[model samples]
Target: MALAYFVLGDADRGRANLRDYYLAIGPDHADQIARSAGTHTVALKETIESFAAIGADELILLPGLDDVNEVDRLAEAVL
Candidate 1:
C-alpha cells in the first residue's frame, strides 16, 4: 500500500509509523489482541460483501499482515 502510494507520487509512510501505533502490552493482552483481530477480519469480510451487494464501488484494504511466514502463507492461500 505504501509502495503504491509512492508509485502514485504520494509520500505516505507505512513502516515509518510502526512504533507510534503498536505497544508492548505483555503476553496476556497479546492473546486478546490476536483473538479480536481474527474476529474483526470475519466481521470486515461480511460487511464488505454486504456493501458490495448494495452497490459499493470502492473498497480499500490494508490486510492483517504480521510475520514474514504469515505473509507468504496468505500469498499462497489466495494468490
Candidate 2:
C-alpha cells in the first residue's frame, strides 16, 4: 500500500529486521513469523520506492528466509 511506503522509507532496514526476527525464532514460530513477515511486507514496498526515488536502474529483491506467500504478496504489490 502507498501508506506503507509513506511511513517506512527504507526497505533495507526493514528487511534486516525481518531477517533478525526469523533467525531468532526459526521456522516453527508461526506467530512471531507472521508478525515479522507483516512488518517486512510494509518495508519491502517502501524499499522499492526508496530505490526508485533515488533513480536506480534495476531493482533486485532478496527476501531471505521468509514466508514465501507473504513475500510474494509484497513483491506483487511493489513490482
Candidate 3:
C-alpha cells in the first residue's frame, strides 16, 4: 500500500485527513491502514527511506488536504 494523506510539517492536519479518509472509505482495517500514512516530515522521510531500503522502485504520496502549496512543502521537506 502507498502512503496517503501526508502533510510535510503539520502532523495534526495529516491525522485529521486520515480520519476523514477512514470515515469516507470505512475500511475494515482502518487502524492498519492509518499506519501507512505519514503525519509529519520525519515520519514521511522515514517511510521513504524504509521503502528504499526494501528496494522499492517507486513510492506514491497522496495529499492530506486540498492545498496546492502542499507540493512545495513536500519538496522542501523531502526533495
Candidate 4:
C-alpha cells in the first residue's frame, strides 16, 4: 500500500502525524514507512512523478487531518 501526507506550509504537522502513525503501527518497519510520507507540496509532486515514472496508473492523496486548506494547497502545488 501507498501513503502520503500533504501539508500547506507546516511540515512539522505532517511529520508529527507520521510519527504518531508510526508509533501506532509499532516500530518494526518504521524506517520504510517513515520514508513513504511527503510532508510538503514539492515532495508530494516529486512522489507523484516518481510513481508515474514507474507506471503508476493512479494516485491517491489521503489527508492527515481535517483541514480543508490542504485541497487548495494540493491544487496550487500539483494542479
With a 3 Å backbone cut-off (N, CA, C), the pairs that clash in candidate 1 are none
Off by over 4 Å in 1: 1-42, 68-79
All candidates in order of TM-score, best leading: 4, 3, 2, 1
Better of 2 and 3 by lDDT: 3
Every model's TM-score: 0.28, 0.38, 0.69, 0.72
Q: How accurate locally, in lDDT, is each candidate?
A: 0.36, 0.48, 0.69, 0.69
lDDT of 2 by residue, 1-79 (tens): 2222111224355545554655766755533443433344456666666767877857655443344554555556666
lDDT of 1 by residue, 1-79 (tens): 1100001111122222232234376555543433333223345455456657777767443334443444444334334
Q: On residues 1-79, what C-alpha lDDT tens digit does candidate 4 reach at each position?
A: 3445565656567656666777766765554455566766778889898878888767887765567887877888888
What is the Cα root-mean-square deviation between model 3 and the actual structure?
Answer: 2.8
Provide the clash count, candidate 1: 0
Tell me the lDDT of candidate 3. 0.69
